[model samples]
Target chain A: MFELILTLVLLVIGFVFGQIAEKRHFRSIIQREAETRDLLCFNERRIPQDMFSPHVTLVCGSVVVSVDFFKHFVATLRNLVGGRVSAYESLLERARREAVLRMKAQALAQGATSVWNVRVETSSIHQGQRQGIGAVEVMAYGTALVPR
Target chain B: MIVTNIEYIPGKKITQHLGMVSGNTVRAKHVGRDLMAGLKNIVGGELKGYTELLTESREEAVRRMVAQAEAIGANAVLNVRFSTSSVAAGAAELFAYGTAVVAE
Candidate 1:
């Protein structure tokens, strides 16, 4: 009974705190995405020679995020039904977006007008002691072309 | 060395191709980081420790790949790619590959 109560309490606390953090992260991502609108990013292998810049360099950004206890708990419950695990969906989405934003920021810092051949790679760094996932890592990389 | 994911550099010419070069590293999570990550699972956010580990592993892999390219007397590495795989429960392997080339 005591262990049950502790688990419940932790779940409630995790839910409250996790919700706040997720909302804050989403807000920041949206704001930054808007600010980086002008930094062109693409997956094309080639950039038009006419618009090409002689100075080219590599840029990369990485983010590692984990799911809160409550979400993980809910996800486990959903797994019993064997359907989509929406809890993890948002976690990965945020990580991917954040990684891209950071890459764009790096390119901008290097005075690059655009990034080409952008690639995003994701991996699970930690699997939870429990059945759920513990942490995920997203890495975004690209070649930046700095104008003369 | 010049490393780009693109097959061809914008203005530079590829004078010679030195074939494919690769570097890989397998890294395991330390006990302290595993403990911290366990705690973070409660009210989670970013996992800084894991991020650092990945960054370091990637840099190491890239460095080794560049070393191989240099050994081949290549000035550039083009079409670079990275791959990651789980080697163990708490460990992962990061592999980088690219074609070494001479750009003039």
Candidate 2:
């Protein structure tokens, strides 16, 4: 009975707090994305031929996002069903967007109007007996074009 | 040395292609950081500790890559790429690679 109560309590805490944090983070991401829309990003390997003036540099952004207890639990159950894990989908989406936003911020700070050849790398971090994802690291990098 | 992911640096010509160079490092966060991350996982948020670990590892990898480039008489490294993998239970491997070239 005690174990059940404790698990229930943890679930409640995880659900309530996790939802609040996700909402808040999403709001912040949306606002920052709008603010940084002026900086363009492209994955094309070739630099624009018409682009003149030649100041360029490299920029990168990285972030680590952890899953809440409730989401992890849900994902584990999802594994049994062999289908899409919605819990992890949102988590990855958030991490990827956050990483790109950070990269754009760096480029803008360097007086760059756009970034070219953007690349993203993701890796899962495990801790303590590989008990479900401890966290995920997402890194975005690119070459920023600056006009002098 | 100039490092960029693009094949060529803007306003510069590649006088020589020195070939590919790479650097890799495996790193793990301290116990304290792992503890904090565990706590944060309950509530779901950004893990600053892990982020710092990745940043540090990436810098080290890049530094090694640069040293290798310099040894090859290259002034720039272009088309640089980064990769990350979990090589052990607690350690993450950060790898960087690019072509070294002489630019003028």
Instruction: Find the candidate with the highest TM-score and give its number.
Output: 2
Q: Which stretches of candidate 2 lie above 4 Å from their native place?
A: none
Runs of candidate 1 exceeding 4 Å displacement: A128-133
lDDT at position A110, candidate 2? 91
Reference-based TM-score, model 2: 0.95
Interface RMSD of each: 1.8, 1.6
Question: Which lDDT tens digits does candidate 2 get at residues B1-104?
Answer: 89899988877889999999999999987777777888888888899888888889998999999999999899999999999988776578999999999999
On the 0 to 100 scale, the lDDT of residue B71 in model 2 is 96
**CA lDDT for candidate 2:** 0.89
Error of 2 at A16 (Å): 1.2
Cα miss at A16, model 1 (Å)? 1.2
Q: CA RMSD for every model?
A: 1.8, 1.6
